[model samples]
Target: MELGACPKSMRYGPCGGVRTGGGCEVVDEPCPFVGRPLVEWAGTELAPRAIELPRFLVDHRPTGDDRVDRQVLDDYAASGVAVLLGDHLDDPPAVDRVAAAERTVDAGVPTIATITGRDRSTDERAEMIDGLLAAGVAAVLCVTGDHPSARFTAHPDVTFVSEGTLLAGEVRSRGGRVAVAESPAAEPTRQRAARLVEKQRAGADIAVLNHSGPVADVIAFAEQASALGCRLPMYAPVPVMTDLASMAALEQFPGLTIADDAVNAMHTSSDPFSTGLDLAVAMAGELLGSGSIAGVNLSGVATSGGAVERGRVMRRVVDAVTA
Candidate 1:
């Protein structure tokens, strides 16, 4: 009777798991929904979705172009993982793509390049697209890079020149898998729903929901995605601020809610490593159970070590839940 639980009609295999669909059969139970197949609201048949978990990448800037940063990227690629680069780096969007591509050349891990709207010129965008194709970066997360407002000049510097959805479409047309970032509470629920529909319509292959709020909010958001008739993948963010300075910096991000207790707990905890593992397990369980989510996107922090650790945690969680 509970959502995500096994249906009655499905037969169980010898594996001791419920076989709701054709994927595999569980051993010890009768199918709950005997005659009723799990179908999308529009009456479409459902399919098992595989998840892609990549390492989160950060851009490190040192005055001008730095070889050190490139070396750091080499280390990241060695893990056969992807990363997100900061937008502040020179050339912003395209530079990250180029850097990531360079690493992919040697490491063989796919790169999920970030695109910031401001630093990208028409020419740069063209070159970046060419570079991505050449490097074969798996997918691109299109976002309007974060911009500062009114620090000095009367006119503050601007951020993303175009909307993320439109930009994603452009990338997709050019033979790239495009993912766009959206916030559940960037506005009211209705507004978010409308925007999500529009993004799907515009050719976004995946939607990344930054850190989730209440469970109800996430369910509602997933329902909206289903209604939009677009089965694009959804990436959920799980924040990682295991220390005081990091926690403080995270709190400053707009729309982020890091509980004071949670922050302090992470700071003093001796077993933060285990804590992260536990959190990843819980999140992976929920994500896999949903049947709607295609993959898990680890957001918030960016580093080779951080991404590899989280990716390992995710892999463990997936094996547990799916098995």
Candidate 2:
């Protein structure tokens, strides 16, 4: 497939959002990178390794409301887990990421900020990374974000100047820690591990695996990546949905697949809140006990006004895993 055929124009080929049947997430065609040879990293030297992340990493989104966002940060600080801050597709408005990171750092929480190559030029992304690091974030997650939907019609003609691989190098060049993502369940599953190897060569210090099908899938992906010479510390995502609203929000995430049994448990149980929390703890324990992954990321979202409750659920999972 031609590079020009890809909507994201990614030098790294297929991203994590490729549909189950090998279709592009942005268009109704097969992914250009599908059935193509794995793209090898052209660079010679790898980025210097950064500091190792904590055992428990939780996803967080600042709602652009100071009071609500501060309460979330304080919860994470007290829970003793690192917070990975990024843009949620359904966020109210774009928060000042640098300011959020500063607040998180001030609250004594380890912070990892995400920089996406979506609607932002290369120079603009560079500025974001510098600002995040300056605000004392522990690392930067470089990603080729999901293509903008109709809600983002304002920038209909936005250009993607850098994909995750290029942005990983940018983060390392500035002496910032770099984390990259891979989808083990996306199309070209056999090549997903190789793709992560290429990202590692491009200077990624860590790999955060997307929500694949099950814990077994994550373990298999980790094994393949390790065999293909990927040595970065890897974190697997565990969905944390305590209610239908949270579950619905997570289901909207592109390319993420929660296990069928877990989903059914949440949908059919009389009390979804308790059922969801229990399922999360079980899944996290299984992933960590597999010994294939370095850690587990509590990955999900909350309804409006449900952030604190969701954080409490995540904290319970952390405690169970540590206990």
Candidate 3:
């Protein structure tokens, strides 16, 4: 497969390159950072994250089965996109949907399932993860979730659940990839640094940042993670929802102040949907250009024609960065 203008050496393949026919070929070169401004970032003391597109393709699908909308799943596969299944626990329906969607999409790319503390008991969450693994859901993202219980009624003060270390151990024991969430805006830089360390210690395979801030802040957080010996890939989730839903998610949630800042920081139309997508795309451009961000995840956004439009935007960012 010709990688267009991208250099063969920088081209990544699946499985982070292997010694298949040659000694070591990049099976999946997430993105290019070498010769980029990454070196100047914090004096080169940070982990360069892979260029990933972790998208929410089928959120709260109908039919209560594990099956996602076939068209939705297919679009993800066709576009080289990965789906992060929704946040439903306790209801076997939600858990089953992950597997069904994976099978339905058959995209052959990596897929992740989200595990939230509010959704299931600790044991139940573990079982749900196990089911995801059995169904080929190797990657898992652990979050505090939106509510105290699966009912979405309560809002706890602190929601950073999954005890990063324990969850990573669980996934690793099962030989699966595990990811955790991070927010530069969640706490003081020092505290965020400590939490990142804790997550790394928990055997997290990657870190998915919740909020997007200045390039300096982004680089600082990435640097801090590296200082702690966390080479795990890092990602940023860009919300692409209708303006109203995006605004609601931002305004309603106590921790969504960052999203509000993101909205305020941008100079776009007042319309939420257009504003969200435009801002998401712009932030994505910055992330890709940073050379420190590994990849991006698309969330809080609705799909268009069964496809995650952000993936296409990401491709443009990747091309620009690599070029």
lDDT of 1 by residue, 284-307 (tens): 556646666655554443222444
TM-score on alpha carbons, each prediction:
0.63, 0.94, 0.64
Per-residue CA lDDT of model 3 for 99-185, tens digit only, reads 653573365655677765543556776777777777776477765443333224543433333433445566666666777776555
Ten residues in sequence with the least summed lDDT for candidate 1? 8-17
The lDDT per prediction is 0.49, 0.82, 0.50
Clashes of each: 14, 0, 18
lDDT of 2 by residue, 1-323 (tens): 45568888888778778887888877778889888889888876595485656788999877787888788788888888998988544556657878888988899999888887777776788788889999998889988877765234444565667788888989999989999999888888888898998999898888888989778888999998999888888999998887888888767655778888888887899988779878888988998898898888999873334777667777888888788
Error of 1 at 313 (Å): 8.0
- RMSD per model, one decimal: 15.1, 2.0, 15.3
Model 1 has how many clashing residue pairs?
14
Weakest 10 consecutive residues, lDDT, candidate 3?
11-20
- How does candidate 3 fare on TM-score? 0.64
